[model samples]
Target: MNILLENIKILAENENISISKLEKEIGSSQAVLSRAIAKNTDIQAKWVLKIAEKYPQYSCDWLLKKEGPMLREMTKNTDIYGLLEDGVENFKILTTSQKQIIESLQKVIFYLEKQDETGRQEKNKNN
Candidate 1:
């Protein structure tokens, strides 16, 4: 998934809001939002501002960085993961086992995402 889309998904899941609802709240069309998420088109500053306004809890920096805290506030001694403070060569030195572990974690995350989507749909149905 595109980074922007991942950010959008994170915000949606965190706020318990549907993509459609979020698009509407941000004054953007579903097609525009979908394209932006897919990385097929660029998102304008206005769209970002709208989202920031609607979700004041999100940090713009965190939204753009995989290593940053999802929430703006950080507790002491928090070991943030996926942070890249070094060069690409450093990342390339990871062992095969490390790569496998990361892949496995990604799969697990995808599974949880599917469950979250199901729950959200069910909740919407109930309402």
Candidate 2:
């Protein structure tokens, strides 16, 4: 499979979502990804960027060059809000990478809470 398709599948798996659902979020044409995968061609850059924007865990570099891990490995020292060090008023000025990290962290938090909720339900059912 092409890196583009592989990346898309990887992103969906990581997000615990279906490819069609992910395509919707990424603003891709219906079946565009599937078609590309079937044809075994490179995915459009615009679609790649859209996926990257929605799910920053998928490293852009890895998507583009097939280098590094599929997901970005963040360190505890990651300066998620360092861009606001100058002032909070200019948070809009943060670079794309900084914004992506913040977004990715939000997604992670949501995913964890969902897992916790499911676990609690399962535990209650077992009782």
Candidate 2 lDDT by residue in tens digits, 10-103? 7788788888888789888788887777777655555765776676556765665467788787543344466556566445545555776666
Residue 114 of model 2, lDDT score:
67
Q: Let me know the TM-score candidate 1 reaches against the reference structure.
A: 0.50
Model 2 compared with the native: what TM-score? 0.58
Show model 1 residue runs off by greater than 4 Å. Answer: 74-127
* Model 2: CA > 4 A from native: 75-127
Worst 10 residues of 1 by lDDT: 74-83
**For candidate 1, what is the total of clashing residue pairs?**
0
Residue 17, model 2, lDDT: 88
Query: Which residue pairs collide in model 1, if any?
Result: none
- Scored by TM-score, the top model is 2
What C-alpha lDDT does candidate 2 achieve relative to the native structure?
A: 0.67
Q: What lDDT would candidate 1 get against the real structure? A: 0.60
